[model samples]
Target: MTFLSGWGRTAPTPATLVAPRTAPELSALIAGASSRGLIARGLGRAYGDAAQNAGGVVVDVAGMEARWSLDPDTGVVTATAGMSLHDLMLALVPRGWFVPVTPGTRHVTLGGAVAADVHGKNHHVDSSFGAHLRSLTLVTADGTSRVLGPGDELFWATVGGMGLTGLITEVSFACVPVETSRVRVDVERTRDLDHTLEVMTATDDRYRYTVAWIDLLARGSRMGRSVLTRGDHARRDELPAGADPLAFAPSSRLPAPPWAPNGLLNGLTVRAFNEAWYAKSRERRVIQDLAPFFHPLDFVDGWNRVYGSRGFVQYQFVVPFGEEGTLRRVVSRLSAEGVVSFLTVLKRFGPGTPGMLSFPMPGWTLALDIPAGQTGLAGLLREFDEWVAGAGGRLYLAKDARMRAELLPVMYPRLAEWRKIRESVDPGEVFRSDLARRLSL
Candidate 1:
C-alpha cells in the first residue's frame, strides 16, 4: 500500500497506486477496480483530500508520458493529462506563448488545473483555467473514453468536479500570446484595510494581473495592511537591448528541511516575519521574470514544511462584491485574535466559469495558511464558514480540508445540478476520493 496526502501534508491515507501509460490502460484499470473504487491523481496539488482515495486505487496520471502539441497560429495547445504547467511553459514561453491563466505555482498538472478550474492574479481580467479549455477527453466509469466541450453538460460538470465525474485524460486549451516572459510590476504598501481595498477597487481593472499580500496579524490601525503588486506582461520593446526577451528558465529550487518542529511558525515568529516583510516594501515599478512575479514560493521547494509536522490548513474563501463587510469582518477578527497565518493573500475575482461547482465568483477572495493544530481553529473557521455562506459566498473546494458537509449545498446552490450530471455519467460512482466522501459531493 502507498500512502498519499495532499500538498498540505495532512490526513494522509493509504491506497493502491497505479500509473497507466495510455488511455486504454487507465480504462482497463477502472473496469477492474475493487469495491473501494478509484480516483485520478495528477501532480497532487489540490492542497486537501481532493486527490486522495484512501484505501482505494489511485491512478497517478503524472507518471504517464508527457505529450503535447501546439498550434502557433492560433496559440492553442493540446496536451495529455499528465503534463505539468512548468513543462508546458518551458516549451511554449520560448515560442512567445503563455498559459492563459496560472495559479500561485506552475507545478500543477493540466488535468488538475481543469478539475479545479484554477485561477490566478489576473482573474480580474481573465477567468479561470476552464474558460480557456476548448475540450477535454474523459474516461468514464464504464470504460468509455469520451470527448466533451462547452456545449456538453458533462464537460461543464467535469471542469471543476474535483475529478469525481470522470478521469480527464487530455485537454485542449487556448494560450496567451506574449512577447516576453517578464512582467512589469508595480508595488505599493497600504496603511490599513480600507486603504488596501480602496486602492485595489479603484485601479485593479487597469492592470492585467493584481494581488495583495495581507499581514493578517497586524491589528488596530494597521489591520489588513498589505503589499499590493500589479503588473502586465512586458512588451519586447520594453526589454534591455540584446536581452533574450522570451527567456523562460526559472530559478532552481532550494529544498526545505525534510522535517520541522511543530509550532515553528508561532504567532511571534510569524508576526516578526510579517513586520519585516511589510516594512521591506516600498512603492516601485520594475520588470521581473514571470517565475518570480507569479510563483515566488515555488523557488523554495517544500516550503509547507515550515508550518511543521502537524501540517497546515489552507483556508480560501470568497465573498461577493457588496459583501465586503463580511470580508472585512473576517480579516479584522483574525487580526484581533492574533491568529498566525504565515501566508495571507487577498485578490479580486471577476466573472466565474460555467462549471457548476467552480469556486470563483465576482468577489474578493482571501487565502490563509494556518497551522492545523491551532487552538479553537476549527470553531473559528466554522463560524467564518457560516458568515461566508450567509453572505452568498463559498470556499474553494480545491483548498478545503475541514468544512462541514451540511454547508456544501448552501455554499454551492448548483450542487444539485452538478450531482445530477455526475450521476448520469458515473452512476455506479466508480470515481471516488476522500473529498467526495467527506463532502457528499
Candidate 2:
C-alpha cells in the first residue's frame, strides 16, 4: 500500500497502488476488485479526491504501453487516455497543431481531462474539453473495452463522470491548428469586479481566449481589482522578423524550494505578491509564447509544494450570467473575511456540452487557490456554496476537496440521471473513488 493525494495535496489516504502494463491486466484487476472498489489515476492532478480511494486499489495507467497518431490535415488525434497534454503538445506544436482545449496546466492526462470536462481560458470561444472529444474507449466494470462515440449515451456519462462508470483507456479528439507558437495578447487593468465583468462581457468575443487574474485580497473601491489578458494564437506575420514561430521550446523552469514554512503563503505574503503582480500587469499588448500564456505555473516544477506539508484547497465555482449579483456577494464575502488566495482566476464560459455532470455552463467561473490551514475556510465556502446553489450554479468537482454532499443534487440537477446511468454500467459498483464515497455519488 502507498499513500496518495491529488495535486492540491489535500486528504491524504492509503491504497493498494498497482500499475498494469496491458489492457487484459487492467481489466482483470477491475473485474476482481475488493469491496472498497478500484479507480484509475493518471498524473494525479485532479486537485482533489477524484483519483483517490482509501483502502481500495488504485490503478495507475502510466505503465500501460500506449501509442498515438496526429492527422495534420484534420488536426485529429488518436491516443491512449493516459497520455498527458504536455506529451501531446510536444508532439503536435512543431507540426502546426495544438490541443483543442487546455486547462491552466498541461500535466493532466487525457483520461483526467475527459473525466473533469475541463474548461480553459478560451471557454468562451471553444467550450470545454468534452465538446471537442469525438470518442473514447472505456473499460467497464464488466471487463469490457467498448468504443463509444458522441451518439452514445455512455460516452457523455464518461465525459464528466469522474471515472465512476468505468476506466477510460483511449480517446480520439480534434486539435486546433496554430500558425505560430506565440499568442498576440492584450492586457487591461480593471479597477474593480464590476468594470472587469463589463469589459469582459463587451469585448471577450473579440478574442478567442480571455481570462482575468484577480486580486481577491483587494478591498474597498478595489475590492476585486483584476488584470485581464485576452488573446488568440498569433498569426505568422505577428511574429518578429526571422523568428521560428512554430518552435515548441518553452522557457526554462526554476525548481521550487525543497521545503517552505507551512504558512508561507499566508495573507501578508500573498497580498504582497498579488499587489506586485497587478502593478506589473499594466494595460498593454504583446506577444507571448503559448507556454507562458496557457500554463505559466507548469514552468515551475513541484510548485504546489509552496503551500507546505498541510497542502491547499482549490475552490472553483461558476454562476450563471444573470447571477452577477450572487457573484459580487461571494467576492465581497471573501474579501470581507480577509481570506487570502494566491491566484484567483475569472473567466466567461459559453454554451456547454451535454455531459450530465459537466461543471461549466453559460456563466462566469472563478477559481482560487487557498491554503487549507485558513481558519474557518470550510464554513465560509459552504455558505458560498449555498449562494451558488441558490443561483442554480455549480462547483467544479475536479477542484473540490471539500463540499457538502447534499449540495450535489442542488448544484447538478441531473445528478440522479447520471447516477442512474452510472449504475447501469457499474451494476456491481466495481469502480469508485474517495469523491464518489464522500457524496454517495
Among all windows of 10 consecutive residues in model 2, the one with the lowest summed lDDT is: 62-71
Whole-structure CA lDDT of model 2: 0.92
Off by over 4 Å in 1: none
- What TM-score, over all chains together, does every model reach? 0.99, 0.99
lDDT of 2 by residue, 1-441 (tens): 899999899888999999999888998898789999999999898999999989999999866786899877888899998889998898999999999999999988999899999989889999999999888999998988899999998899888999888999999999999999999999999999999999999999999999999999999999989999999899999998999989998777889998877999988899989889998998899999999999999999899999999899999999999999999998999998999888899999999999999999999999989988889998999888999999989999998888889999999998888989988999988998999999889
The top-ranked prediction according to lDDT is 1
Those runs of model 2 whose alpha carbons end farther than 4 Å from true positions after fitting are none
Clashing residue pairs, backbone N/CA/C < 3 A, model 2 = none
lDDT against true structure, model 1: 0.93
